[model samples]
Target chain A: MQAQTQRYSVLMVDDDPEDGVLVQKAIASSGPKVDFQFVASGAEVLDYLFTEGRFTDRSSAPRPNLILLDLNMPGVDGFSVLKQIKSDMDLRRIPVVVLTTSEAETDIVKSYDFGANTFITKPSSFSDMIEVMTSLKSYWFDAARLPTA
Target chain B: MLAIYEYLFGAASFVPHGYCLAWRPDLIAIHALSDGVIALSYFSIPIALILLLNKREDLAFKRTFGLFALFIFSCGVTHLTAMIMLWEPYYGAQGMVKAVTAMISVVTAISLWPLLPKVLALPGPGQLRKMNTQLAAEIAEKNAAQVNLHQAYQQVEAQVVERTRELQALNQRLQDDVRRRSLLEEELREKAAQLIATNAELERFAYIASHDLQEPLRKIQAFGDLLKSEYETVLPDEAVEYVRIMQNAAYRMNKQTKDILTLSRLSWDSIQFDSLDLAEVVEEVAFDLKERIEEAGGKLEVGPLPGIPGDRTQIRLLMQNLLVNAFKYREPDSIPEVHVEATLHDTGAPGTGGACVEISVRDNGIGFAQEDAERIFSIFQRLHGRSEFDGTGIGLAICKKIVENHNGAIEAVSSLGKGAVFNIRLPTSQPERREIHAGTDTAV
Candidate 1:
């Protein structure tokens, strides 16, 4: 398994289009630009990661460097999605970062328990979102090594 | 003592009722001896009287006196009668005087016959009991009077104590009333003072929500406009995604406005009241959340619900919010489980009305930190992450308001990751509406 402390393509699995867009802006402001993709639901993420059906071009779709998950989405929320990602041995080493709009303790603890690499709160302001994104870039890209592409 | 035996012995004289003894010196010596013996009779009555006087007090003094009087009178009469018999002379008058004196002494001794046996009957212990029996009724009457007086005094004392307690309680009530009135006056002043501050706060909140939050939201919306209208065809996928990000923040801002507005409205002093069946209200909520429950692969086990007096709309809102929260915070490994139970109780519990009912909702989900147990019922008190769970944080707060409106109580108990239980107690029977005779209902 590749070490989690490496740069790879990131995925955002969320239902809210608005939240997905906000997270994208936050990531853009962050340094050491990395490739990223978005999926609408846990099912789509799983299918894309597994190269199933619509996601058959496995070579083109890179293994996720990290996953930013939302727990309260349509079908098979973030927790179930985390369970599947962590359970699959081939994909288990990939880092997971939980990006949420709440600071509830239960979510933080559960995110860690399910093997998330980091838990970040969704900023209420656009500027704070930028800060969260810049920090993510510094920690994951500048301070840590990236897996060979 | 010698007096009676003298007669029985036939008192001898010097002359022997003739001149034989008087004429002979030897015979006269023998008569002198007999005369000397008869003279000892006078000492007997005094000795008998002394014996009678020994136990004198216990004997009714009057009876003793009367018996003594009888003794003396009979003694005198017998003495005089013997004196007359003795005076009937024989041959010589001087000699007859001597003989008569002898007969008088003998009769005086015999006078003790009737009185002797009676005098010997001194007071014994049995006589005391006999005396007590005779006087017992009188003694009892006097004692009964004293006891009755004592009992009446005790009753009076007890009444005084009871009155003292009542006066103390009344004084305490008055003191409490004064304290409460002062508190109310203070609260009225405080509320009056807060009216201006509250208005100012409300205005500030509206400004923050409208302007500060709207800046980024508007920028996001404009950037989206700029991208879609100007560069939609030429821009790369990544560049278009950037514009979409800005637009998403704006849209969320618009939604937050509505949520905040509803929260502000919740602060309004709107009294909720309506007489409705609580059971039917819960059923409606269960029906509304049926889809969520099924999707979670959990069943909402509703136990028998008791019909109670409450606001139907507010109660329905409370059940809906909590059940939603349960489903949202489901444990990863375990399916969500919720048990809703309601029952009425009368035992006049502390938080309960003399006749009140309780509704309990227990859930098996990801429980929160113990510290959050109380705060979870506050506005915007979310225990789980927004990315992990979705909530406005005001759901439990609304439930609290609904319960309080019914003059009821609500509380939550939870352990970390173990589960949580919410208990709600509401007055079932209005104090004034209670029947003169209440019907007991124990529905478990």
Candidate 2:
């Protein structure tokens, strides 16, 4: 079969601006071309996903093909956001990958229990970060098939 | 004897031969009255003696007193006869009565002669009074002694009552002390449980802090790497060197945070123990370190290892850390050789005490000083500089923590240039589930 050349979009939620910039740069450095959007906190992730408030223009803010969720934030943390996404009929089909600095077993287990697709610890070096992004892109975009968006 | 009795009877004639003296009424009355009074007095004395003797069965010398009473009675009869003759002639009867009285007197005198010495030896009334006074004095002394004894008895009884009361008071105090101690112990137990929960919470916080702290450090290192690689051609050499230094520091900080997280994660509550074959753990560790072992030209000889109760992942990590240490710290000219051996060791004697699995990992490495053997297990304690060996200095500390979580003991023995041997003793049976309670007062 011919390789499906479908473009994908990712919504990343993180409170730290530096971490968000680093992840974007690392993904851009690595090959797979993906459209990325950044939201500061978990509450903004829900608004962006449902096209509410500032994200009311659904055409301009496209639905994310995948969600990169951070666990710790000021309000409405990643766990609750994940719960809201997985429980909603419109957003349950979207794959949610938890990317956080916490390597705690409880965090990993809780993310999975809340219907996260994958849990990955953010790598500490540029090389390691690139390697992780490469693997994530290959597995989600190429190997696994997604529902119609 | 019959003829004498007849003569005595015929002698009772009324008159004698002539003695027509003056018969004066006054003289007659006086004489008869005096004789009658004397006779009555003597008769009363004998009757009283008879009554006394009859009444007092324990009275001494009964026959002698009877003889005295009879003699007195005979004398009274003689007086009576004399009085009767003064009134009537009766001279023959009077003469006969006199004769009888004389005979009785003679017999009484003879009997009295024998009893006279005995009567004379008896105590007089005056002497008896003196003896009675002495006896009364002795009785008074005895009564006084008896009173003193009764007083002493009362004092002793009082002392006993006092002692009993004191003992009861002491017993009550002891009971109160025991109750107070138990209450304090219960409160202490509750405090200990609370302390353990707080300690667990603190550890969790440490883990979270270390984990979260690594994120920014990671970003710094990544950006520094990107800056270096992307601008290597355009940037000056000094800027590249600065980036290199920044990246190195970031890398070290990252490693330290990771080690801290590992240390905090080594908690007993999170460990699950099972019967594990340590040889399998060693094999896996060796496989994982195959490249390093081959590069170092190391020989790992693993002997028959016994099964012990322990957390599988922690035990694997412990073996890996030790093996890596053995491979890393080798003599300059010597080939690395590590011998891992396990044996069943009885704490006391066979079948007497608990059985333990004694595991020894001996390495042919450049050994540390003897004093540093204990210090090596402390976190971030390094004997050599970072140039000599590259490590976070947390491997042995993690190993120690893992062994402690298994309720086991671990120690290292080493001398300069003689290599090091690590001995681990683990119970074959499951260790008791230990709850992390607060420390005791003494421990605190």
Each candidate's B-chain TM-score, in sequence, is 0.46, 0.64
Model 1 Cα shift for residue B58 (angstroms)? 60
CA lDDT, every model vs. true structure: 0.67, 0.82
> A67-133 in candidate 2: lDDT tens per residue?
8998888889989999999999989999999988777677888889999999998887888888988
Each model's fraction of native contacts: 0.00, 0.57
lDDT of 2 by residue, B1-444 (tens): 766555544434544222232556666677778899998998899999999999999877788778778878888887887777675555555667778778777777788788878888888898899989998999999999999999999999999999999999999999999999999999999998777878667666666557656766787788998887789899999999999989888888888877776776675246667878888889999999999888877899999987777888889999999999988897666899999998887782223357778889999899889999899999999999887888999999999998887767889999988889999877777644444332211100
True contacts kept of 1: 0.00
What is model 2's C-alpha RMSD?
Answer: 7.3
Model 2 CA lDDT for position A21: 81
Report the alpha-carbon TM-score of model 1 versus the true structure.
Answer: 0.37
Among these predictions, the greatest lDDT belongs to 2
| Model 2 lDDT, residue B336, Cα | 95
